[model samples]
Target: MHTVAVLAFDGISPFHLSVPTLVFGRIGAGRNNGDPGGPYEVEVCAEHPGTLRTPAGFDIQVRHGLEIFETADTIVIPSWISGTGISPELHAALHRAHARGARVAGLCLGAWAVAASGLADGRELTTHWSSADALARAYPAVRVRADTLWSDLGDVITSAGVAAALDCCLHLVRHDLGSRAATDLARALVTAPHRSGSQAQYIPVAVPDAADDDPIERAMLWARTHLGDAIDLDGWAAVALMSRRTFTRHFRERTGTSPQQWLLLQRADRARLLLETTADTVDRIATDTGFGTAVSLRHHFHRILGTSPAAHRALFRREDRVG
Candidate 1:
């Protein structure tokens, strides 16, 4: 059995901690379909063996210390306290584990700790987008990609944020086991077992108070339903009875992105859903989503999603059909 160790540090997010435990810690008795059913032995090792406080004001008791790392086949660093300095001993242990060929995982804020360990040098990485600026400033040598959900560089995997940690863990399971096993596990966990790691993080849509009210909300809903139509900025502004400039400003404030970008994203998302759930050809999906051509759809999917439309479809395609 592969031994998995999670570094339970102070101020860790409870959800971040639970992600790995739920994914790898709780191994069912069923065959991992083809992979070893020996299952992963999960141990939560902390700097000190005792109860630790979370950022949510909750407490969790950890019985093992850093010594548990000696047997770890993979070491996971969940969310970490940014300003808190890492101890020399813990650093040495992580360094030693990496030196001996143990896979290292840094989820969310935990990327800072992995970066601090000097293991991620010359490698691509990601963290919570909110901390991208700080992480870039702190570790200039590491290539910080704010666009990706996670970066899996074979041995070291870094995930973006709270929910994205699940994506990273699923990637690990898929890589360590197989796609079928990962899918079964994901079914058990009620998540997309094999979602592409490159999918964009779904930033919440924020609309201004006036826009959040009745008429503008109705207009926005209309626009969403009619993405394939010629709904330009001026057209939307007309729907809202505002000047194009005012509408653009208000829309940007509400959506945290330009109107055109948001529209494109929604259309691409729509196309993706259709490709996954329906048997539509790429060209048909393109026309349906206002992209006009399969080339345009592939271009946008690759540009925004970091993967081709066909690849995206293959990942989420219905189970009954063969890719």
Candidate 2:
């Protein structure tokens, strides 16, 4: 069996630690799957072995120490403490692991630790979108990709946040076990079968401040209410009583995204709400949300959420049924 050593630390998120375990645990001995790499073993190790406390106010028992990284075929840092200096012992272990051809993965904030190991220098990776700035600042050589859910560069891998970590591990399964097995695993886990590593992370919406006299706010409100209508940039700018260029700049400055991108996100959000609450057909929801057709809605849905509209509905609908 190929051991996959997952590095744990104090204040680790339980959810992050469990993601790889759940995904790789299913891939025991790729014999049935026709892989010659034998079984995949998941081991949770820490800098200081034993019980570790999580931010969720719970403690976990870990039996292995950093020494496991030596024999492990893959090493995963499942989220790290932001702003905390990585210990020399851990850094040396990671460097040795990478030097011996063991794949290293960082999920969410764990990317910082991977970057600190000098493994990600000049390589683009992602972490939680909120911490992208800090990751870039701390490791100037590591290119921080805030947009992607994960970046799988063979030996070195990184994922965005909690949920994206699952996707990243699934990618590993697909790489090792093949697509057919990955699809079955995803279906068993009730997740998207294959979300591309390049799929963009969902951008959090920025609500405009409610101000009666603010033209930009008013224009945004107007555009939101009239999502079914074609929202032209010039027309939207005209509603704000500003020129197109000025409106584009100000809109980006306000929301940190272009008007078109904001509008698309708004439409997708609306579609999600409708899908979750009502039994609207994909075509109807698409039309109502200004996507024009089911295909367009599915396109944007995959682009943002990395899943199809029907699949998304099934998830929420299944939850409601279970509830």
Name the best candidate (by lDDT).
Answer: 2
For candidate 2, write residues 89-200 as lDDT tens digits: 9889988988899999999999888888888888888898888998899889989998888997778999999788889988787555444556677887899776556556
What overall lDDT, based on C-alpha atoms, would model 1 receive against the true structure?
Answer: 0.77
Q: What is the lDDT of residue 76 in candidate 1?
A: 92
lDDT of 1 by residue, 41-140 (tens): 7888898889889888779999999998887999999888764447899899998888888989999888988888878888878888888788878987
TM-score per prediction, in order, is: 0.62, 0.62
Q: What is the lDDT, from 0 to 100, of the residue 152 in candidate 1?
A: 81
Candidate 1 deviant stretches above 4 angstroms: 28-37, 202-323
In model 2, which regions exceed 4 Å deviation? 29-38, 204-323
How far residue 231's Cα lies from its native spot in candidate 1, in Å, is: 26
